[model samples]
Target: MIRLLLVDDQELFLQGLAMILESQEGLEVVGTALDGEQAIARTRELQPDVVLMDIRMPVLDGVSATAAIRRESPEPPPHVIVLTTIRHDEAVVDALRAGASGFLLKDARPEFLVQSIRAVVEGQQVIAPAETFDLLRAFAPVRPAPDASILAELTERERELFALAARGLSNADIARQLWVAETTVKTHMRAILTKLGVASRVQLIALAYEHRLIEV
Candidate 1:
């Protein structure tokens, strides 16, 4: 079963979500926290596979909390899905930089939420297609330029993998497109992460953009 931790300031919403998630097969709401502090504490103790975190909270916000939790966790930190009302481009960029596995609207459908958790746990991203254009536009004014330097860090195959990742393609999608095994894609991704000095795919994209290695 996929273990989950819910962290949101809304008591009613947290409890309601816990109940709803618990009812779903192959998933379990392992714990709930009201703020970023409690969320970090519970995470240290529970070590859940995924954390459903709210962006705004009383003590600390989701972005800071995600960064803290990610730093404290062992390699391969637990996946974090930011549940927020804010869909602003800045917020999305900040959340991704903070190491969140995904940014999802608070009212996302239950099935989608569950799928996001599973996808993140499986080392795949789950960006909402509805927000893709908006996010891409956020970086449109100064679109990335061609940079041959990035190619030095990746092998030919790894470059192909990173290109797909730069385009926001999931591992499964990249695997199918390349006619390679998903495990191979994952291996290339790990090398990309190490060479690029980024912990998550979000940062990978951010770095790629900063270095003019990839265009949106």
Candidate 2:
């Protein structure tokens, strides 16, 4: 079963969302929190498999709470998907930088949200690639003297896959573009992540932008 924790300041939304998710098979609503501080506390207590976190909240915010959860959690730490109202908000980027698995719009279809939770558990990012690419372009700053030597750690094929993934392409998309199996792309991605020491593609994108490696 995929254990989940929901975090949002709005009580009504939390109740409604939890109802929808709890109805689905293989899912369990383990807890809910009204603020980031509560999120941290509940997460430590429950140790859920996933957390649906709202980016804006009182007493704390999702980004800070995500950082704390990821930093202190045990092995196979919970996957955090940040929820937001704005598509191009910089806080989403910050959340991703702070170790969120990805961002999801609050108005997404229930089925899509449900699929995202499952996909996230399967090591797939739950986000819109094109929009996320645009978001990175807008908020990711370019250094005057960028250092991307860490990219050298990747093998040639891994570097190619990294470039496509940094541009927000999915593993399946990369597989189609590279004329390989999706599982093959997934393998390369795992190797790339381990080589560069990034936890997810979001962090990989952040690292690429930090080093000005990807052309904006």
Candidate 3:
């Protein structure tokens, strides 16, 4: 079962979302918090597997809370999915930079919300590639050209796979596109992560954008 914590200042929305999530199979609403401060306290207590965090809240906000949880928590920190009303808000980018696993628009379909939770838990990105590209293009800061030495670490095939990954292709999709086995894709991804020094696919994409590695 996926243990989840819901964080939002809106009491009604918090309770309502908890009810909906708890009713789904394989999900357990372990706790709820009204703000980021409370969310941090409950997280230390409950140690949930995932946190559905609101971007704005009283006392503390989701982005700060996510940073705290990720930086201070023990190994296997809970994955955070920021909830935002605005699709292209800069706060979404801040949240991701602060170590959130992903973000979902508050009005996202119930099925999509559930799928995002599962996807994040399974080490996959929830944000669509196109949307992520747009977000990066709009808000990501300019950086010096990507380090040639760093780029040299990846083989030509690995670079191709990394470019596809930055474009938001799933492992299965990448495998199909490259006419390789899913396991092969997974192996390549592992190597890519090690080479890039990134912990997740989302971070890899972010790094690619920050370094202007892909045109996106």
Candidate 4:
């Protein structure tokens, strides 16, 4: 079962989300927190597989909390997905930079939310398709061009896969597109992450955009 922690200041939202998630098979709501500080504490105590975190909260915000969790947690840290109400908020980028696996709008369908939880746990980044372009565009102006030497390290095939990932394709999608096994796509993705010195696929996307590897 995928263990989960829900963090949000709104009591109703948090409880409702917990109820919905618990109703799904293969998922367990291990705990819930009202803010980032509690989220961090619960993460250490419960060691959940995933955290559904709200971007804005009292005590500490999701981005900083994500950074702390990623930096301080032991091996196999919980994957974090920032929950936000806005579609194109810059905080999503900040949260990703801080090691969040991805972002999801608060209004996402229940089924998509469940699917995203499973997807992230399986090593896929999960930004909503509609928000992908806008999120990338929001980061374009401020990001420095990606390091050319780092970009040069990718093999031709790796570059192709990287471009696909930057375009918001999941590992399964990339595998199907290239007629390769999903494991092969994952292997390439791991190599890409290491070569680019990035922690997540979201960062890879940002780098791709900054370097013009793929059109926005």
Q: Is candidate 2 or candidate 4 better by lDDT?
A: 2
Q: After aligning candidate 3 to the native by TM-score, how far in Å is the CA of 16 from where it should be?
A: 0.6
Q: Provide the overall lDDT of each model, using Cα atoms, as 2-decimal numbers.
A: 0.80, 0.90, 0.89, 0.86
lDDT digits (tens) for residues 99-158 of candidate 2: 888889999999999999999999988886677778888897667777869887778899
- Model 2 deviation from native, Cα RMSD in Å: 1.7
In order of TM-score, best first, we have 2, 3, 4, 1
The list of candidate 1 runs beyond 4 A from truth reads: 129-133, 139-151
User: lDDT, candidate 3, residue 186?
Assistant: 88
Q: Candidate 4 — what's its lDDT?
A: 0.86
Cα deviation at 200, candidate 2, in Å, is 1.6
- Tens digit per residue, CA lDDT, model 1, 111-184: 98878788788777777533644564574333345666866967888888887787678788989999999898
On lDDT, the stronger of 3 and 4 is 3
Which 10 consecutive positions of candidate 3 have the poorest summed lDDT? 142-151
Best lDDT among the predictions, by candidate number = 2
- Order of models, best lDDT first: 2, 3, 4, 1
Q: Give model 2's clash tally.
A: 0
Residue pairs whose backbone atoms clash in candidate 3: none
Error of 2 at 8 (Å): 0.8
Task: Quote each prediction's TM-score.
Answer: 0.88, 0.92, 0.91, 0.90
